[model samples]
Target: MSLFFKIPFDKKQIELAIESLELQTSAELRVYIERKKKNQHFSAFEQGLDYFNQLEMFKTEAKNGVLIYIAYKDQQCAIIGDQGIHQYVTEQFWQQQNRLMIDYFKQKKYNEGLINIIANISKELARYFPYQENDKNELDNEVIIK
Candidate 1:
């Protein structure tokens, strides 16, 4: 039973959000969604890191890739940032963003919540890693569903 159809967001909306974010920073942001969990014991954060690695997020020249992993059926999600982003943002910042997102999810505002979250992250990324003339989007903006 894939929850993919039930998830309110369309890939284009997420892609547009990522595109807007990347226009302001060299940093990359990606979204990954899955219908269910592979292991009940694994936390969303742990599984996010696995996909982050598999996506080669850590290989960014600036180490500024960010991943938003969601298990729609489980109603759990995690946001992960590479070391470069960690240097600029505190744990509390991430927690705050998570809280905000959860609040929106509770209201079923998936599209609005994710778009806003990406915008918030873009501010920090722009501050620390402002876009360069030669900067290219090194990561795919296409949302992934698995």
Candidate 2:
């Protein structure tokens, strides 16, 4: 019963988050970004939604790492991570947002509207999987349905 976390996000953030995961040395990982079929000509938002839905197909797996989702709404973007990495990543994301805001403020170009939008997106990304403790054997026995 390894805990499962779900992140609903948008594409650019998802790409950066994946890059951050790749920097981790202790985890074995695989990342799937939903690619829009070139011939279909879907809108960017539609393509992101398709990828997010595709992630649901892997919900049953109990691997010892994370999965991510990227989604969009109107002009906002989001990133969601699996339970294994949610807390750490979400915290890091907020920290990053603060840094960005500070940088903008320091330049005396503090755009309140832009900052609020970023904050809103970050808030949406902060959702996490409720923690659950599981035995080693139980984790090992878990299966991911494709």
Candidate with the greatest TM-score versus the true structure: 1
lDDT of 1: 0.87
Prediction 1 TM-score vs. true: 0.92
Worst 10 residues of 2 by lDDT: 137-146
Please provide, for model 2 over 5-123, each residue's C-alpha lDDT reduced to its tens digit, 9 standing for 90 to 100: 43232334434443333333222222333222322465433443455455452243433243322111212222333455544556666345545544544554333422343434433
> Which residue segments of model 2 deviate by more than 4 Å?
1-21, 25-50, 56-73, 91-146
Task: Give me the displacement of residue 140 in model 2, in angstroms.
Answer: 23
If candidate 1 were superposed on the true structure by all CA atoms, what would the RMSD be?
A: 2.0
- Tell me the spans in candidate 1 whose CA falls farther than 4 Å from its real position: 1-4
Tens digits of per-residue lDDT for model 1 on 1-146? Answer: 64435567778888998999999999999999887766678898899988999999998898999999877667778899999999998888887887787788788887788889899989977999999999988888899987
> Would you estimate the TM-scores of all the predictions?
0.92, 0.27
Q: How much RMSD separates candidate 2 from the native structure?
A: 13.8
What lDDT score goes with residue 90 in model 2? Answer: 60
| Residue 102 C-alpha lDDT in model 2 | 43
